[model samples]
Target: EDVHIRREVNALYVYAFCLPSCREYLSGSKGEGFLFPWSDLDIMVSKLPPEEISMESFHNDCAYIATTNGCKPGFCKLIQSYAKCDYYSRVEFLQLKQHAGFNVNFDQTIRGPCYSTNFPDGFDCCYALPVHPDSSNVFLRTFKTKFWNGVKLEIMNKNITVMHCVPKGPEKGDDDGHQWLISFSILEQNIVHSLNHVQF
Candidate 1:
């Protein structure tokens, strides 16, 4: 688990360097060392663009963004499908996607990672999953298998861990009071990391 966290930390740092406007730090229960075997890796990124402008290396950032967006379609379906499942439910489909390098996370009850920058008023947060070119091609193949009654018959991956979060309360309800509020896990992480060491 520590190894995975280190890898995730390095990945986020590398990706953050690609985006000059962004500064990120580890955040979440895992960031706070309060995670169990099953916890999502969280990294909080704040946008802080530098004042100076340089035209010489602008294409690299553009290319990096393009590559990140050009992920396989199965990856999208896997996230969407898993997200729709119970946030803590051990859907076998999730295990497969995790092996495929998809980070199983949550944004409210969405059951997946938050990757959008354009949000409505009073809500603005964005995160991008870092991809490795050398990782095995597990994403495309996950589409071939079908889940049965919210379960899979195949053998589960033992290496895969499950992280659970506290249940959403009534105060977290949306404007319609039907949906749970969006996750502030990232924000919470920032708060956790910024605390005074001895006092906290």
Candidate 2:
């Protein structure tokens, strides 16, 4: 029991520091502290719209360099042509912790919902997705870019989503017959949190 609590508490703190602006709450069996060797730890993060996020110290020159030089370290890539922010990958959670000046070793994976439906082009789905670090390294991190005041960009790589779709079905095909869906975990979180403490 002590070991389980210790592990959970440690993970919770790491998550808190990793995503300061995100809301952290308990929602599953682990949150209730009733099981050992759990399959997954449920952590709910508040999803913010693209308007609320921005990338700092990024510009066209940065993207040009990244594109020309192939997105090297200390550089960024422009995933969207008209996006107000720049996307930064190849950095890991440990690197961010170091940037924040902390010495701790804990690894956890927080996930969200993905589904299938029909998607239309030029439409803004507005869903927040978990951006995983480069898969090459287990400790690599991901960030979401946002701009503040049309300047002073803030780059947060931990939890951000993009608007994209994938091939659905077994053969991996796309035909627009209910093969895509927009994520709604953020709405679900709002609904769940609305419950009173006793009900929660």
Candidate 3:
């Protein structure tokens, strides 16, 4: 219990230093304040020029059309809708560039959407695009379900702004570079935070 408290305090301390405008988030076990000897940190970093979920047009170079073509359930391919810029040509390169600012020594392997690092401690840093729940039909349907009725109002009233979609390819798809996985890290964190000690 002492370790858990320490970890929570440390997380809060680190969060305090983040600029209000920054879109970085600490997630997984670390964000939930559960630390064991084997705990690994999970960090989600939101990308700039947020991509819109549009099927008709691409407003800018950063815009992409999220399609489920050639992907498994819960995965989608972010097909570039406009002419690609040199900097944001590929998802892999963009994610790598985003994670390069971290001080840790990362492993060569890319695990899903995150870059894994073993230096100092194990870390999985994922670069993602933020999407609002209001804009997503799936999210809207989910919130209306009976399971969410108990805490629906509380969740809606929370300060949560966005959920993330990580840049990762489907397991069996040839277009591995354009695949993205929808992530509910922020919502999961909120649920965990709302739990009582016994429920947790």
Winning model by TM-score: 3
Worst 10 residues of 2 by lDDT: 147-156
Candidate 3 lDDT by residue in tens digits, 121-177: 778877777654344434544564444434545555552444566776566754436
After the best TM-score superposition of candidate 3, give how far the Cα of residue 87 lies from its true spot, in angstroms. 14
Off by over 4 Å in 3: 1-15, 19-22, 48-65, 79-91, 98-109, 145-151, 154-159
Q: Write the per-residue lDDT of candidate 1 for residues 1-200, one digit (tens) a residue.
A: 46455546764764667566544545545555564566555554433322111111232212211111222322211112112332222134233434443333323222333232212211222333222111112322253433222121221222111111111223332222121112334423333333444535
TM-score for candidate 1, please give it.
0.25
Assess every candidate by TM-score. 0.25, 0.26, 0.69
User: What is the Cα-based lDDT of residue 57 in candidate 2?
Assistant: 28
Cα lDDT listed for each candidate: 0.31, 0.30, 0.59
* Per-residue lDDT of candidate 2, residues 90-160 (tens digit): 22222343344222212221111211122221111112222221211121123221312211121123322
Q: Which stretches of candidate 1 lie over 4 Å from their true place?
A: 1-18, 50-198
- Report the Cα lDDT for candidate 3: 0.59
Select the stronger candidate by lDDT from 1 and 3. Answer: 3
Query: How many angstroms is residue 193 displaced in model 2 relative to the true structure, after the best TM-score fit?
Result: 2.9
